[model samples]
Target: MSSVLITGASKGIGRAIAIELAGRGHRVIATARRPETLADLPVDQRLRLDVTDQESVDAAIREAGEIDVVVSNAGESVRAPLESVPLDEVARLFELNTLGALRVVQGVLPAMRERGSGRLVFVSSIQGRMVLPMIGPYGATKWALEALAETLAIETGHFGIQVSLVQPGAVSSGGGERAKVHLKDNDPYSALYQELPVLRGEVVTPEAVAATVADTIEQPEPPLRIPAGAPAKQVLEARKVAPEDKPFLAVPLNW
Candidate 1:
């Protein structure tokens, strides 16, 4: 059985993935900001990991040791237009969504390279490929993730390390509906956000994304990019075939 380590497993997609992988017989190591929050996860271990902290990341990886699959699933987003986004909030988003994953990959990759076999999966978003006005900061971070994952896949191929990017369309974590982050005065993209529709009825569940993640990880040669939802698939297809399409920009109201 392969050992799989997931970051941000306290709840949502990360929690679902942890549960599914554990059920599949993999030795699952789940980490979150608070270990107690993940006490109910059916995994081999639940760890306390604040992805923004270097020490926390280092300790978690050292403790998990010899992981066959590393899934970077931690992320946070502040919803606001480019003009309204606060500089500090933007930095924090990058710290969690992009750099946090990069740090985890850096910590785990050496061991994987030495073992000559491993998989690294990054949870990105459809926004990574397309730009939306208020979500520019969040989308910027995912774009960075895509760049990093693609580069790692090319660089680590000879070392028998596989890197894959999982781009999911909007997912309903339930908690997301209640998540409120601050936006600033300068963030003028409010009009754009107001124009976009919200998906009140059709949102992909965390469980669905988790199952897709499990399948992707188990593949012997997973592709560089895996779309985890129908919306994600559609956006990815459009990005690949028709670079000019911008339908996803109006996804705020409904995609």
Candidate 2:
């Protein structure tokens, strides 16, 4: 079994993935900002890692030992229109979601390249491809992450390192509870903001996403990108054929 290291493993998708991989006999190293939060997980190791901090990332990588796979799942989201979102919050979102993933990648790539065999799985989102009201800030970070992951895929192919991007749609995680909403009392998009959750409809379970991650790791040659949930598949497929301006509008908003 492969030795897998996952970030943001205290809860949600990351936590689910850690549990799934461990159950499948993979040696899993789960890291969260607070190591105490991961104390109960049945994984090989629990580490305190804040991806935004390079020193923390490097130390965790070193401690984890030879990682066969690295899942860059540490991320956060903000709900706000581009114009209305606080600049500082937006910056923080980008720092955590976009650059944070990169930090982990930077820490692990050297050893992976030296071994000439490894997997780098990035947990992105369908929002990386399609944007909706109040999701601009979060979507922007995902978009940037997609670009970075895709570029890394190309650059690292020669080293026998595989890169996979796992995109899920409206996951039933605590993301909503943690999201920073920026809605002013008199904001023009107040109505839209109120309608956003309704429009999101049903969400996929975190276990579904974790299963996909495990499957990806098991594959000798997994796809470069995978839409982890049904909603993600529908949205991504629509984005491919639908008009650029209103892609996936016809796919029904139940997703």
Candidate 3:
């Protein structure tokens, strides 16, 4: 069985991935801010890892000496227009979504390179590719992650390490729930585009995304991008051959 390490495993997609992988007999090293929350899984070696902290990331890597797969699953969400967003919130979003994942990758790559056989999965989003409104910053970070994952795949392919990106269109998670709560706070451009309520229901359960991830992990040659839901699949396919003038919706319907 391959040894796997997944971040943000305390809840949501991260948690489901951990359970799925473990159920398949892979020895999983699950990391979360609150390790105790992972009590439901095989947790003899649960880890406390806040992705934003370099020291915590480094220590977690050190603890998981010979990893076969590393899933960069930690992230946060911030909903607001680009200009109206506070500087700190924007920074936090990137720090958690982009930099945190990068740090984890850097920490694990050395061992993967040494082993000459490893898999790296990035849990990105559909918003990474196309943009709507009130989600530019979030999408920007995912876009950056896409670039990073692609380059890493090329750089690490010769070493027998496979780098892949899994774009879950919209998985219902703690962060999403939190965003829903905040969505009604009345942001800058709320009144201007308030005719979209159907967009609000565009979310798939974490279990759905986890199933695709498990499939990708078992596939012989997984693609660089795997859209996770019907909406994401449609958007990705449409955008693939879409006309330049056509616009694709990337934000929630309520936004």
What are the per-residue Cα lDDT tens digits for candidate 2 across 33-103? 99999999999999989999988988999899999999999989888888868999989989999999999
Question: Between the candidate structures 1 and 3, which one is better when assessed by lDDT?
Answer: 1
Which of 2 and 3 is ahead in TM-score?
2
What does the lDDT read for residue 24 in candidate 3?
81
lDDT of each residue in 35-144, candidate 1, tens digit only: 99998888998888888899999999889877999999998766665655678888988999999999999998888899899999998888788765566788899999
By summed lDDT, the worst window of 10 consecutive residues in model 1 runs over 246-255
Cα error, candidate 1, residue 155 (Å): 0.8
TM-score of each: 0.90, 0.96, 0.90
Per-structure clash totals for the candidates: 11, 0, 1
Best by TM-score: 2
Model 3 Cα lDDT, one tens digit per residue, 1-255: 778889999889999888888888878999998878887787436888899999999998888768888889988876666666677777888999999999998888887898788999999988778764666777888999999999999999999989888887666775754652124456557753353335433778888888777788888788888888787888778667867786765343543
Candidate 3: deviation at residue 104, Å?
A: 0.7
lDDT leader: 2
Give candidate 3's whole-model lDDT.
0.80
* Order of models, best TM-score first: 2, 1, 3
